[model samples]
Target: MKVFTQFTDEEVRKAQVSVLELLLINHPLDCPVCDRGGECPLQDQALAFGPGASRYEEAKRTYRKPLPLSPLVNLDRERCVLCARCTRFCDQISGDRFIELFDRGGAEQVGISAGQDFRSPFSGNTVQICPVGALTATTYRFAARPFDVATGDTICPHCGDNLDVNDAWACDKGRFAFSFVDQPTRLTTPLLRDHGLEPASFDETLAAVATWCRGGRAAVLAGGRLSNEDAYALSKLARTGLRTNDIDARPFPCDPSALPAERAQATGGMAVTYRDVELAKLIVVVGLDAEQEVPILHLRIRKAARQGARIVVIHPRRTRSYDVAEHV
Candidate 1:
């Protein structure tokens, strides 16, 4: 037969009911103080598709409970809606399997394995995916109100290419990491070591550099640490201003040809938008440690999977994506 498949409205409604059932039984019904509160799938899905009232006695299920297994993770049982997204996270996406549910029925709650602690590098994401404040970060516990923080959308300079830091708060590492530029350890004045060493003022530095390039051959071997403005300026000077293409800030050892073209940049470049992931029926990430490389994407992927998208992870080495993903 010809390949064909489609979910009927009734089938879709049933799937929605299944999701709602999970929320009714599992979610703590608490949204305040959670980082994922605004970004919460449970909150959005339940409000739209779940029962407005509880079927079971609310007191029967755990709520506002706490598990102190990892300093990075704080498990509040009362808030857990028992979605299993967190435990699935550690197992399918991360391959850590550090966290899981204990007991059965109403007694069930999220936790690290008995006498153990969740300790994966990406373990912190569990706190972000938790439907309620049930799971929280020790580092971000009770931090500023979400509304008080201003967000900036910029790709992380570190790690692999494409990541949209959705609601990157002023308190986020993206902002805090800028401290190095203002730190005393930073090389504010250009220094040239005897084996290429010496400190010089801005003007002196320019003159010295000009003298080197007077021979008609010089290159700016910059790093990804530079801001987009700085990289663009240097590139302009080398390419347009100087009629040379030697100014470069290649981040990794990959091929130079792989860089996005200027046209692509105008159309938002080789960047993978959140819309791409959302619309995808099945996404296969091959040979990449997405957890270590793009942590936030994993969170969004979790959200997408919850919404019925299939995620496949095929990595040579162990990875966190191995845990939460559907087709691991």
Candidate 2:
């Protein structure tokens, strides 16, 4: 079939410019102080596609700035472009309909129902996906500019792409609970027991540890949060260097036979993937609060329920999945 895609077309270019102009009609001119200043998609697009100066001569619409939606998120109604990214994320992806577009015409804005807070475990995602500075993280508000901050590429320990877990999404805790690293009380240097936990250099600490390990038996008990590579390194050090097999990565003991079939599949390396959950006809969740514990899994279960799967959640108390699953 013959088709005409309108890229570089004069009419299409004019239409794009007009859309940018309309989007910026009520957008605040506070980009200097805005958290998303250098990294804002709206700002970049406006500079690229919008006219040199705005034709909006009338007084711009305004609202009370920086409304706290929850303890984690702040909303600026005037900066909102009404693209519905946050609202749609709540309603469609997270299944947490805490916020929605309110009112009509120019007065319309994103807001929560009376007495409701945007307390969803996935609420931070809205801020991450916002095109403008309308939604800003409370912990990260004005923390640093894009130019001031240095970034490093690292695989997230919480969720990763290999498993298709939390694909393009993360729970609030994984997304926003990083402020503790800057605390004054946080240990930046290793400590030695020369007197009473005196600060020591890494060389001194490692030498002391090596001496102690050589003099006596040593076993490695690594945290469960260690990455696969770290765990492997630790395992190698314990088995090869220390000549010991008394190394374990699990924080606690778990009986494989007691685990649910799906969990057992995972623990036993049998590969019960998220696709299995989506295609499941009947899913029985046993003693797992998937929403608070494993949110992405909860989302997958919800998606399955939407696609005609029956979900039964068996727990001591009700959970957030009660809306989509039968609570037992």
Q: Which is the leading candidate under lDDT?
A: 2
Return the top candidate by TM-score.
2
How well does each candidate superpose onto the true structure, as a TM-score? Answer: 0.50, 0.74
lDDT of 1 by residue, 1-328 (tens): 6533224466667777776786566455456756657766667777777766666665545444457767666777767767798888776655567788888976776776667877766665666666566777766677765667787656644443344445421112332344466678877678865677778788887777777775437666887556789888888877665556666565544323334332244654556676777677787766555555455566556556766778887655666566557775
Ten-residue segment with the worst summed lDDT in candidate 2?
157-166
Residue pairs whose backbone atoms clash in candidate 2: none
Give one digit per residue, the lDDT tens place, for model 2 in 165-229: 23557777667655566789989999988668899899999988888787338898998667789
Q: What would you estimate as the lDDT of candidate 1? A: 0.63
> Worst lDDT window (10 residues) for model 1?
167-176
How does candidate 2 fare on TM-score?
0.74
Error of 2 at 146 (Å): 2.4
| lDDT for each candidate structure | 0.63, 0.80
